[model samples]
Target chain A: MSGLQPCEILVVDDNPGDVRLIQESLKDGRVPNRIHAARDGEEALAFLRRQAPFESAPRPDLILLDLNMPKVGGLEVLRAIKASPEWKTIPTVILTTSMGNGDIKGCYEAQANAYLVKPTDLGTFSEMLSSIQSFWLTLATLPVG
Target chain B: MTQTPAPAISPITLHLLLGDLPGLATCLLGGGGQVLEWTEGAHALLGQGREEAVGRPIADLLRIPAESPLPLLGQRAETWSLLTRRDGSTFRAQLITLPVPEGHLLLMHPALGTPQPKEETVRELMELRQALDESAIVAITDAKGDITYANDRFCRISQYSREELLGKNHRIINSGYHPKAFFTNLWSSIARGHVWRGEIKNRAKDGSYYWVDTTIVPFLDASGRPWQYMSIRFEITERKRVEEALLEKQAELEERAAALARSNADLEQFAYVASHDLQEPLRMVSSFTELLAKRYKGRLDTDADEFIDFAMQGALRMQVMIQDLLAYARLSNTMEGTQRIHLEDALDAALANLSLAVKEAAPTIRRFPLPVVMGDLSHLTLLYQNLLANALKFRHPGRPLELTLGAEREGGHWRCSVKDNGIGFDPQYAERIFTIFQRLHSRAEYPGNGIGLAFCKKIVERHGGRIWVESTPNQGTTFLFTLPMDRSPS
Candidate 1:
């Protein structure tokens, strides 16, 4: 853990408030991490592909995605990441407010690393983010980028 | 002009003429108007046998006045005169004189101011024939299947002249609409001397189609063989048209009803989906307001704290209302989870779910035996939970609450009821209480989103049941519902 660099996390969400709250929650965690935000699924794809303006962006250690959005939805992004040879090794987690059975089943079938419903309670929401940081960033081993 | 001499008469010709006028009395007269022969008909009519009055003068037998001119030898005449019977009784008669080979044949009969019976019979036959021809399309065919008689109505309806119809069979009017078996059955029935009645489609000379209700009667000879067939027909084209139009209208109505049902189902599905999506934003509002109240209370001004509390309360209530709306819409969307379940077990599950409220209220509860019913078990549990929760929420403040749950078989259904000694409402509001979001009490008095009773009603109806309430203000209330014992899959 000492030799490793700070973890880079990418959060993809349409709502700016939700993205800010997630960043604030992850800041309280023990693991050293840097947060990068994409306003929607398209920007997240541009960052992942390192296109033009994002040519110097670092490969994200973990990706958090929202289900419902304006253009491309979370399920399609999950599928795109799992299909690519370069991005498939990076763990992608779905964190959305939809607790519907169909959404949960679809995300899992798309090879999402984990599925979490955004809790309505502020404490529970922060706690869920801390758990994701602890487990995906500190505990689990990943292939080096 | 000079008058021609009359030809001499022969006795044989006079005798043959007597047989011509059947059912009438006749006597032969010589050149002097004396009776030459008294026929058997005359004896029967005038009470005089031939032996008693064969040589009497025609005028003497008829009592004709002397001044009346006698009928001439070559002319025909008729006059009313009196006739004397052999018994000396006299009656008025119609005397007819026709020239014969001898002189004139005088025919006499009692004059009742009407035609003689023989002539009246012939006139009646002619009148009956005219009536049949005017009212019906009549046709007769000989034993060899050739048309022997066709009335004027038959020729008019067939669009053919009388000359063209005679000596021709009915094949000219065949429309070919009926199968071969139909005609075969008709022929066999008529050939067996049975009257056949049916509806037939026929074509006219102008190639127009028409429907007819027909009856054919066979006239048989002494050996029981049919000599001819008479067919009577009435047009039924208008009736057939009306029947066909009615069938088309009925089919159209059925299709429209099916389409309307499909649209209704689509609307219900839309409502369910819309309500489900509405929950996300509502949850965010509620969560943020709570966060504001928790983090800024006492740090902000007193007024700001109070305002945040109000906002939090509003968001929470809206969240509850939207959740209830989703539940109500879901009842219509997923009605397929139905099976046979024990009502007792369902009631137990409801009580278990409301254990906290039951422990807090400490209400006295009684349960009776319940029958097994075919329904969605979770829905039934929800129905019971809502009713029980209502009873607890509306319990009388001063007195201990009492609750009863019971069910019994009634015909093909089980009549189940939940009774409670609570603050009952007015009977007039019973029907409105089951409608979605209809509340009888203010939110300050009783806290509810007013959706429980609506759920109960929808669940019972989906299981082929009916639900209603009976209540008395300030006394008690009973919620009664019926569930069918057996149901076919829809």
Candidate 2:
């Protein structure tokens, strides 16, 4: 058996259904990965900074962020992530229900690694999450945390 | 009257007779009609004594008739004559003749009254010529239009010398601006003995152009044909230039006004496209619902599954509403395509589109006679569909749903009404109910995004019309709108 370490992914979304969907999609994905969840942008940033409750949490190799959330929306979190020297290397992908051109360009301008719109159909949404896992976590190599 | 001969007087007899007469004026003439031997009364009457008069001729003292022959010395003669004084006054007299020692001695006596006519016509003609030369550009052309006479003003304005201009046809100064027909008309007018007056643009010897207000008067001969033409001209080049500039400015202002209208139309198109871009986010939400329902269908518990089902339904409803809004925003883009539309046809289309909803509500639609109106064809269909759908959607729960669709002519437009016997809204919220996203009822009571009536209002207003509502708490609701009968641009 190949003894590669399991990839760590942090999913940030305000909707509990969307966060649960991401977790289910990754659990059924072909890659060996561990999925973490944050209910809002504030919690996602806290985990990324390893502060307090997140001190014992493993450093995530990837982040899937929603544009809209309860506090500290995706653009502010993306900016905070890229601005810090510690967490700047993590690949942050934007996944949201908004396919607006302004939102897409705003994320890219704020140094988001990639932008993707969440699919509405359950089958397509699972396929997209699996593809994200296969491409970012399974194939790509990451720096030591 | 013929001259009659007078009685003769002898000179020796006259000297013997007049020597004794003190008042007798006598002159001893030399061979060539000179005078001599003046008497004292003669010197006083003639104002010339013997010293001044002795060597002078007798003819100088008299106004002699040219036809009368002077008699020789010692000849008998009688004729009427005049004697002039040195003070320039003259008196009529009778001539007396006699023979003398050397020349004829003559006597004169006052006869009667007559006046001499003085000549002043030649001087008056000179003053008239000077006045014409100073004021007007005078030119005389012969019957064949050749230059005969041109005054100083004409020469100065034409920049041509008199020697160079004379005998030349009027064509030498033609600027070639006027067509042949223009000159032909002028010739025809002048040929019929009428004075031809017009403004002529003429070229000078220096190749510069000038405009002249001209009047050509034709002089006729005894045979009634024109013998010559006299032209009087005044300069009007400066006035013509100002008029041309004003016309150019007027044309420029019209062009600018047309450009401004085009720019306003472009801005309206931009607004329409920008609203169309909002559809993307609604589609994204719809897609998300489909994904959530498919992924978590049987895996989630009953409550979670039901909640997901509700979210999917809401997303699908929102998607439909946004499509309607997109169609509404695009109305201005097709405003140019609006034409005369029949209200009956619009209502038919609306009924077709809402047949499913109509079947579910089981509403009784009673349509009265409708009229034709002017509006965009597709938009008119959408307008009717929205109103009709609202009528069926908001029906009362207990009683069977009923709808009354009718139209009538109101002044210059067709006023249409869609009334429903539904759970009618309050009269206070009538205006607010038509606003987008402003619902009077919650989702449990009525499932809608509240955009239907707003679309109806926009469509009516864009067609140069109006839309309004009348309703009570539970009796019914009537949505009335107007559409212009005549084809008019929004």
* lDDT assessment of candidate 2: 0.78
lDDT of 1 by residue, B1-490 (tens): 9986765645545555663465568877787887777787788777777776667776666566664545644678887665666655565577788887666787776765444346466579679878888898889987767787899888888899988987888788999999999999999999999999999999999999888899999988645878789999888889988987999999999999899879967867776777777776766777677767777899989999889988888887877787787778777766767777889988999999999999999999999999888888888999999999999999999899999999988999999999999989999999999998999999998989889999999889888899999999888899999997745543
Predicted candidate 1 versus true structure: per-residue lDDT over A1-145, tens digit per residue: 4435888899999988788778877876898888888888888899999985789999999999998987888888899999999999889999997878999999999999999988766678889999998888778977776
Best by lDDT: 1
> In angstroms, how far off is B16's CA in candidate 2?
45
DockQ of each: 0.36, 0.13
- List per-prediction Cα lDDT, in the order shown: 0.84, 0.78
After superposition, the stretches of candidate 1 with alpha carbons farther than 4 Å from their true spots are A2-5, A99-102, B1-260, B487-490
* Candidate 1 docking DockQ: 0.36
Q: In candidate 2, what are the lDDT values of residues B1-490, reduced to their tens digit? A: 9975643765545654664465456666677876655665567556777687767666665545453434544775666555667665565566777666556767766653222322254346457767867787889998889998999888998999999899899999999999999999999988877899999999999999999999999987545788689998888889878878999999999999899768856755664455455444555565566666776788989998898888878777765665566666566666665676778898899889988998899888798998767778778888999988888888888899988989888887888899998888889998897777789989887887888888788788888889999998789999999888855543
Point out the worst 10-residue segment of candidate 1 chain B by lDDT.
B111-120
